[model samples]
Target: MGSLSASYFERAQEVIPGGVNSPVRAFKSVGGSPLFIQSAKGAYLKDVDGKEYIDLIGSWGPMLFGQAHPSIENAVRDALSKGFSFGAPSYNEVLIAEKIVSMIPSIEKVRLVNSGTEATMAAIRLARAYTKRDKIIKFEGCYHGHGDSFLIAAGSGVATLGTPDSPGVTVSTAKDTLTAVYNDLSSLRNLFEANPTDISAVILEPVVGNMGLVIPEPGFIEGIQQLCKTYGSLLIFDEVMTGFRLSSSGYQGLTNIQPDLTTLGKIIGGGLPVGAYGGKAEIMNMIAPAGPVYQAGTLSGNPLATSAGLAMLNLISEHPEVYDALNQKGKALAEGIRQQLSELQIDGFVNQIGSMFTLFFTNKAVKNFSDAKTSDTAKFGIYFREMLNQGVYLPPSQFESWFLSAALDEAHIDHILKASRIALEKTLMA
Candidate 1:
């Protein structure tokens, strides 16, 4: 019988460009037809062809309690009965905003948007207006969405597709958006010194997941904050992937380094399409209806999205222990992968944080985007396909992080480790 996923891809290619809406979904780097998911429950995903695999992407880091959670589904259903969107303010929006403000120290106010891209695009404009400066600094491989300013030296799909710079972004936009090396304080300092007072803000992923779960060095984040303070540049933390996944306050809570602005998405929407940008009221007041900087959307605070987000955040807020449980699972998975590499005598590098990780096909310690590029993409492709064959679904690209949900249990971890052992052994042979 012909594969259902392959058949669907064939038809999709006739209609959808590249047979995928997102570049990473095309599996260009992984070298295989991507699996079309039918449904998900807890820690497992059932493909269109009836193949079941333990899901490790967690919908790209929003399914904290796993797919189709009862409470979240119920919330969405209730919201559906009322309406999907009002195009006006709703109570749930106020509640979610209040919750976020209470949790995140830097954000005294927030405005909801449709996606991370919108939040970041709005944030850069706000930063420019507040600081009255044109240039902004972003770390290499730290993707702040597909904003024209961020397309230069972007990561995630852009990095996976081997095009660090995108075409649509004009030379003027690229010039204003300065790129610096991740985890390298010297590179950032050089930009500040070279640009002088032209820079408006320095934005980064406090715990970078775009470049395959690259962790900041001991004082890297602190140094960036200091540099921003020194240069009068606002520090903005793009916490779309790490926000609620790391802790209630996101990376800011972990490091206690307050940023001038924060951009959030993913978990905040409970896997729905939503994003938000907020910081001190003084700066946020500069946004439209209140201030001169104008930003608006038809579905800015969609009723269904707010309801789902509130449900998810409420669960996380009530069960603080979920973070501990997630970290434990991460440690177990990291150790298991390390053991497999040791037993199989394979050269690999594992970068892991609480519930987010990447197993790079390289022996070098990946501290930055340059180091992450040293990974053997060809070997990773083999390993990814082999793992899929072993009923373990991972991110299609080596440049992406694998997210673990609270839905994953010890049994799932054991199964993933067993699959890894087999996949690694097969990978070496291939």
Candidate 2:
């Protein structure tokens, strides 16, 4: 007899494309049927087949305090009685906006949207409008959501499936997006020189979470900032994954590199589907009612999302020490995994920053997408399945990052390390 999850997936395949809403959720890259989760609490997920695993994905970068955190849950519950969608302004929206503006270093004003895709799309549009240019530059492996332009040379599920460019994107859109090799300043400089005044902006993940938590080289970010200033192109940091999860403000707070515009999502919504883009008041003034460039959403700042987001942000503001604790946890986990890899004599590399981490099945140091592709994905598939069997859930794909939450206690970290050691042994044997 098939498990309940298998049965549901079978049924869903009849209606939903590939029996999953998102491409990564299909588990095509890992070569298996994806687990259907029943519920999540703190650091664990209860699968439909009545199995529980310590969660490391953290709902793909939200769930900072962990799944269904009481504060966010209570905020949602409180909002439920008030209302859902208003098709208009609400107090929570204003409060959350204020909180976001205050927290993020680059953002003086912010506009809410429905998802990270929306935020990036809007941000680029605003950049184009402000700069009066059409072309935009993006890193080869930085996934900035599923917008038409971003699919070219993208990362995450796209890289996992071996389809960097999608089918439906038009030639014009493809041409407008110039891809550069990540962590290489010369490549970006070449693009800027070739395009000159045609490029409107350069959008990227400051600390790229999309291509397995690749950290910026010492001078790479600074170089990008300088080039943007020199070329008169807007610098848009797509902080969708790194925002709040890495630090109280965002990656910008840690780096002190103030971008012209910033795109944010994930942790801000408190696991709700929400996104926002913000920047200098001069540029933001050009959006919608405030200026001319148009964008709107029926449920832009829905009461529930705003309430949950506000609650989460407030929690972060009140407790700045969470960042230190999270970094320690991340460091411990990364170190433990490295030790295991060395002891087992397995060829692997672990890239980590704050709460985001990824263990690549490779011998080379992964500095960019090119280096990341050297991973033995088949071996990673074996490790993933082994970890899953041992009650620890990691991101199914090697290209994606594993997100840690504050919910993971000392025991949880130890469990992860133990499971990883066993998994590494099994992976090596396999």
Candidate 3:
């Protein structure tokens, strides 16, 4: 007899490609059939087989307060009473827009979209329209959604599958998207020097969550900003994962390096499908009805998304101490994992900041895509399976970041650590 999740996946494979909507969800990197979740609440996920696991993914970085957070749930419920998508202007849309502007300092004017992909695509178009340049530069490990221009040298699922450049993206599109080595200013400078006037923007994840939580070296972000300025290119910070998770104003709030445009998703929608791009008023004015660059969505500001997002933003604003608590929790978890690795004599490296973390099965300090590639993925697969069996869920791929939610109490952390210890031992045996 097999698990219900396995049965469901078999059934789904006949209909859904790879038996999962997302590639990574298939657990290809971890080498197992993915768990079909029945429901989630707080820090726990109940799978279709009735096995509950302590969730570390947090819906891939949106569940800051955890799954089914009362505030966000109530907000969505209230929105349901009114209606779903309106296809026209609504009060909640305006409210959420105002809330975003107030929270993120760099965004002077914002336009809402359906997903991070739409936000980034529109942002790139806006940058091209404003700067009158055809090319853009992106860091190697930075995953900026599934836009055709971004598929080249992308991370996340693309990296996990070992396909940096996806099919269907034209040769011309790939050429226009210049790839730069993350944390290497000289590499970026060379690109700028080569491209010169052709580059329109430089988009990157200020604190990359894809390619497993790689941090920016000191002055690296500042150097990128300076290069963008020097080359007359707009700077775009893809904060789909980092927004609100790292801080109220995103990573820019922590670094004080303001970009010309910022793309945001995940937490802003409070687990709903929503995204936005905003920056200087002048550049934003060029979008659609405001100007020439065209971008529109019928469900751009879906009532439920706006309501939930507004509630989430309000909650964060009211409880600023959440950041401190989250940092402490993240530190504790990372430190605990480090201790386990030392005790077990496992060659591993844990990169953690705020509530985002990833324990690479390699001794190399992961600062960029190349370093991240050094990870022992086969060993990680063993560890992932062991952790799942121990009732602690993690990201299915080694190249993805694990998000910790505020819902996880100290007891949950202890459980996770205990499970991790057993998992590590099992991995060694395997």
Candidate 4:
């Protein structure tokens, strides 16, 4: 019955709460039994029942070269042969750190952590320590991990479930995190004026991918940078999803904005778990043995993760064509989806940047979190299920970006286009 999803979910419920490690993986939003993946290769994932679907999520955007990339797999294999973890400084960690610093234009010195959440968490602490300020500003719908500070009006899981503010997050923590609307410059200026010397940093997902791939309205990012400069507040770019995926230097390259600190993950790990925050040496010096603000992870730069990351980064560094290829593919996908939407006479918007995109079924201009929230999510759900039934796997939520990989070629795109037409048709009928 329906592959092993029903049975697997039933069994997993007893062991893993909600039948999955991550809430979204349980497919609670998608309204179907979760397909327990057996394995993945290139742009395709094989479920336990051996059904292959073209993967659009890309493991939430980590598989830049696509699943089971040979170079990364071989590097991980070599690393595994060397023994897993020493808990001390590993050469691969240093190598990966150096590689990241080389690729990212702003990150002069770096620190490694295990997840994007950890990287963002550490970046916030470092900003506080460096500035000696207690308050920070975070935009609505820009998620910088599940850290308590970023819970207010956050995106991704929070947006998907309609839980903007978490119960456990204290008002004191929320107070320190001044809320500003993404792409709106006045809200930020007002927050700075009201807070004065108490503000430490203004952190954001420069492109705001968490809120359904909303690109910064032109000059919005630069405006934020100007305000940060005038106020002497740190500008932290939470590039977890955008870094390496957008370009070699990530979103900063696309926008020509130099942030004081950048939190990175996803693609840098090469499909493994890894996170890093690096910026100017002066601010980075505020962290660890070099300074006072403490942040440490025993598995931060796990050998295998670093090796895989290094291999991936090295490939990107040498062959920038990967970004171009993915960009062209992304443009094709966006254009195809938009054409379908127009023909169906559906009110929708396709927000995109490079290989990351979202087809928000909405009449509103999704410039910020509020605008993104206006999307017709129910219609999206119908489209999602239809696409899934047609052998195309997508992020189960309207609020998450669809990441494209280099592995997606002519056949895959053609399949997705064909399936998408049916999906859109189903949505209209519903």
Clash totals for all candidate models: 0, 0, 0, 0
Error of 4 at 98 (Å): 1.3
Ranking by lDDT: 3, 2, 1, 4
Q: Native-vs-model 3 lDDT?
A: 0.93
* lDDT head-to-head 1 vs 3, winner: 3
Instruction: Find the 10 residues in a row with the least total lDDT in model 1.
Output: 247-256
lDDT of 1 by residue, 148-262 (tens): 9999898999999899998888998888999999989999999999988999999899888888999999999999988998989999999999998988889888886999999
Candidate 1 lDDT score at position 202 = 94
Stretches of candidate 1 off by over 4 Å are none
The stretch of ten residues in a row with the least summed lDDT in candidate 2 is 23-32
Number of clashing residue pairs, candidate 1 = 0
TM-score of 4: 0.98
User: What are the TM-scores, per candidate, against the unseen true structure?
Assistant: 0.99, 0.99, 0.99, 0.98
Higher-lDDT candidate of 3 and 4: 3
Best prediction by lDDT: 3
Task: Pick the winner on lDDT between candidates 2 and 3.
Answer: 3
The all-Cα superposition gives candidate 4 an RMSD in Å to the true structure of 1.0
The alpha-carbon root-mean-square deviation between model 3 and the true structure, to one decimal in Å, is 0.7
